[model samples]
Target: MGNCGSSASSEIHDIDYGHERVVYYEEADEVQKVGSVYSQPGSKGLNQDAGILYQGYGEENGAFCGVFDGHGKNGHIVSKLVRNRLPSLLLNQRNTLAKAITGERADGDLFQSKQVIKWKEACTSSFKLVDKEIKLLDNLDCSCSGTTAVAVVKQGDGLLIANLGDSRAVLGATTEDGIMAVQLTTDFKPELPCKLLLLYIQFLFVA
Candidate 1:
């Protein structure tokens, strides 16, 4: 639902939803040049989808993109909350992790691996924190309302992706024939063998 960039010339639009700050690009051309987004309301008469495209996120050239799909009565609120907050939350988590691993290291595959590990940890921790924040919202009824999130962070030539629920991320690669779409994250459905096993284990413990 929003996009942010580092360009001084880019038009800046700010909208405040309560105390939450939502920043976005006002130039439609600029957003279209980078990527396109589409969301339609479901039969329930409300669109529970939200997305964010952030440029110049962590570093000058870094970017962050995310899509969230909400379900249940308060799905719209949940999706928008995640959309507005997740990018900053993830960045904060990454900075915290980065501070813990300070010092120079040999620049090579090891450096890249370390970067990935830091990002992976940051993403996991941020997601958990977001979930907790949602649960703690006094005005929000989230007992049965939740959103699925799929996000990607681009830094230099590397990409770190995170997914929850059934939302998906895909890569478009130009091949000899044409552009090929490659699926990135696996859908986390309850019917998955791993999920079923975990559920069964929990059920056994309860029984």
Candidate 2:
């Protein structure tokens, strides 16, 4: 649960979460930012959940948001760790890609092409790196426990979404009659037909 806005004060706002720092940028030339977040635990006790909502991601006018749901004994810890780390990892990867592409001469047709490709690459790299780091944590035992992540990034009018596990997202739009809901992702659990087929084949081989 959080809210953020970009101000023209030239000061960087930060809040510490354990050893990690969550940052909010406020600069005179920065883009306008406004958003709020809220969360409530379900009926189950001992909640193990985490989430993020950032109004200015990498560039001005960009946004990033995600939800993490943890399962198993140490699920709470894993969820918090991811919530703290993933955003920074994503921004860093994007910035690195931007720097590498700046030196290359762009063909008019390839200008937007590279930017799109790089953003996708950044998302991929950040996810992999974070997963590896999680596995390497000495104190947390994730052998039978893990977390599901679903994220969305907004760059001006365009959006990029990524998901792992069963979490879902939807877009709401105003229609002639009223507001309508549009689903943006499919459920990625093993119950899906393709995954069920793969699991069945694996069981046969093991038998």
Candidate 3:
């Protein structure tokens, strides 16, 4: 982990996990940006990928990060589109929810009690919307192409994650035996969880 100061209102952080670059965030006044990208590509072809999102996510203390693995013929296109759009979509959903729930409530109250749940809902709706947008694109052919996504949003000491497809997230912790890796999220795949498979089936039907 390393940190560098950009300005009074903003700073950048990088967290390294082995050779893979795991997560990064920038904080500037009311703007926060989160992202992660693998430093190296797969054994096959060139690295066609993306990382992170737009600004104005949350307060200065919060951040959002995501990873995308593109596969198949038009996989690169799909991944890039989602990476570029998901952040705005998520913030939009979160803000809309905030308005609905903040009618007669204090902002700090909502931040203290319901922030994580709010972020979870926002992430879910954003992912679903982005998926639809991908399919609706007139130029892209995603018949056999798709991308795996895993995202995390951090507010103060709280964390919220949303994932789809087969991407995974892990945490490195200090143990008695030195550093240990703990799996934080599952690799959503066809031969894996029954729930994911069912969700995949539902998605297929919906598509």
Candidate 4:
């Protein structure tokens, strides 16, 4: 990995992923201005937003990280959900992705194809469970709490991200558009038509 100082935050951080460097413009608001990814404090949904990033290179295990954005309250729920579970889950499932991609699945094998599908399914199911658990929380300090979540688990040249809400995943691509970047996740606007599908895709795409 590598690091650099920015024209933005005073905090010095070196971001080196051992791959071709990807540039990000990084959008920040007065509040999201904390200059951190997914640091948006949860205001509506579970009072918290959490995310995880796992970089699985060729190593037996991958580099893993998760962030929780707390809303309507402190970062408690987001913190617990990520610190207590997200990391372990990412680690446990990453190898399956690796095997699926690098092993027999490269051929026309439908059986091994299940690995990728399983990964997607697992991530989707996990998000639902997370949402349910957050809703079940009865904290007096956070009765109306809700949280947005994003998680990543990487395997080989493939990366998987799961998300809910506006927290986003953008890809840095070298294109004719001059260091172009695109949002991989759809914004889940609650006021839109088919809000639920958007939300599902939001969670699925880790937006």
The numbered model that scores best in TM-score is 1
What's the residue-level lDDT of 37 in candidate 1? 45
lDDT string, candidate 1, 1-207, tens digits: 333333332554444432223344323233323543444444655667777667667853667878888889998799888988899999999888877556635666666566667888888888889989999999999999999888888777677777888888888888899998977777778878675212110000000
Q: Which stretches of model 1 miss by more than 4 angstroms?
A: 1-33, 42-44, 196-207
Arrange candidates, best lDDT first: 1, 2, 3, 4
Q: Root-mean-square deviation of each candidate, in angstroms? A: 8.7, 8.7, 7.8, 10.5
Model 2 lDDT on a 0 to 1 scale: 0.67
Candidate 2 local lDDT, residue 81: 84
Could you give candidate 4's per-residue lDDT for residues 149-198 as a string of tens digits?
55555443345666665556666667776877866666565776565343
TM, every model: 0.77, 0.76, 0.72, 0.55
In candidate 4, what residue range of length 10 has the lowest lDDT sum? 19-28
Which wins on TM-score, candidate 1 or candidate 2?
1
What is the per-residue lDDT of model 2 for residues 80-103, given as tens digits with 9 covering 90 to 100? 788778888988998898887776
Q: Residue by residue across 26-52, what tens digits does model 3's lDDT show?
A: 445555333334455555664545456
Error of 2 at 92 (Å): 1.2
What is the TM-score (0 to 1) of candidate 1? 0.77
Off by over 4 Å in 3: 1-38, 53-56, 103-111, 197-207
Give the local distance difference test score of model 1.
Answer: 0.69
